[model samples]
Target: ACLSRLELSALKFISGLNSGLISGLNLGEEKIMSEKIRFSVVCVCLILSFAVMPSGAAYAKRELRGKIYMVGEKDEDIPSKNTTIRIEESDDSDVSTDTAAFRLFIKDHYKTDETVTLKVEKPGYQIWQPVAGKVRIPANLENYHEKVRLDKLGSHRFMSNQAFAMLIENAARESTKTVSKSDEKPDLSRYLKEWAVKYGFGIDDVKTEMDKWAADIEKRQDNLYELGLAAFYRKNFKEADEKFIDMANLPVDWAQTQYNLADTYFAMEDWAKAAECYKNVLKVYPNYKKAIERLKLIREKR
Candidate 1:
């Protein structure tokens, strides 16, 4: 114990030095240190140590952060604020969403293999569901970041829990190489059949919804980029704007999409819209030179 406060105080007393510590001990060389003095010294040492050390809330064993954005109609990641972020059932272990960001402290002894669930709650926005928003803390990494996209209220995924369960079952079957448990065979169609009765949907309608979601999940951003470039080169400003806006809506490449859309608007001399798009681009990539240049041009035009 590197020169504990009690010992230090005793040394200070014997050496004819002054100290602020008050332990009720006899300071002279012939005087003995009684049990009461020792007890008082321990209490004083504890108090001093606690006073010098930072409070528990000032630090953490591990920190995790993530971004939250709403999937707007244009597919732009509009920074969200005043949203609630929770780590499982823990309300105080983490902080809420602000500036499209939320932070958490991994204070417990959670294994790397174990995953922590994150749930987001915001007015007019759908709550994040457990099946889709699993946060796996990466092993051997200090910083962990997660990106979550929120849908507007009444647009929550899955009409019912059974539909979500079916999706999970289908995914599990497709990805796993091992045979499923022989003891239990799940009937995925039962969920769809229920949906048919409740929503008056036929097989065709269900298949159509499945196909649409599949296409969206696998959409190629590069194709949209190429098409947007082609339209711009052909002087089809409207078509270029449409293509870029579509790409932006997909939430894949915000900087490129916003820049291209802004550029197309500049070509069409839509100064205000171009300025807006350029500003949007700058929000995420603040130092983007091209966007800065276009904004400068828009300012000059005004």
Candidate 2:
């Protein structure tokens, strides 16, 4: 019969203790004191062996092993190391990974449709979740694999509350610059688009807030150009056309608005109007490469 390392160590320590006790019975105070120290050492060794055995047994019984990877923008996958994995409702069952893999052990097998919430955490990345930083795991599963894509801190998109708040702050800064009398006007259209992409402005609640922001910004006459571009992005062509036309009528340089109006007409398939707008853009901003290319395409089409 084969014995485990713990059992073998326990047996050896017990044998030594028995021999030492027997020898100390006939020995003086010095030998007795030595025996007492040996016995204490053996007791500590035995206790540690027993304590470690159960944890080893529990590790052996782990039925689920998971592999995790971080997905990159180019669809490359890299191991996600140093991440904390936690199972909700399991006492002391959380583990942090030094590598990209983690193992999970349960006291009992799970029932059908049983689910547990899993939380992942890392320093510079967003917490993995369906909405934010939590995910649902089926308890009855085994040998699971997860692909985690965590947005970095201060990135265009962030899932954590702290990161999202940072994104909002950055957006607000850009917003302030839009109405400021700086030598260079900040591109409000691009700023709002980036915010929408990050915060999912397609959702109704997000759209509501974004619309309110747009309304506030539209109060400034200088912001009309960006409002028109934002409307163009939203596919509100009527509003975009109105805003662009309003910008074009303004006394300021209207070359950019003319170009945008041409693009909008092209989207609407009004080739004649588009051609006219392109001509106006070229008249004002000669050597505009895009307008030159578009005119060539329109001539070929005609």
Candidate maximizing TM-score: 1
lDDT string for model 1 (1-302, tens) is: 67666557754554442222334535652244444455666666677677778887666466677777777777677777767777774553444446778777765677675667666766666533333455566664355566777766444353433243334334334423343675443343544455444334574566466545434423643345444534443335477568667766765386678888998999999999999898777545533446867888899998
Task: In model 2, state the lDDT of residue 25.
Answer: 61
Q: Could you give candidate 2's per-residue lDDT for residues 218-240 as a string of tens digits?
A: 66534455566456445465787
Separate clash counts for every candidate: 0, 0
RMSD of 1: 13.8
Q: Count clashing pairs, candidate 2.
A: 0
TM-scores for all candidates?
0.38, 0.30
For model 1, the stretches where C-alpha displacement exceeds 4 angstroms are 1-61, 89-98, 127-131, 139-142, 153-184, 187-302
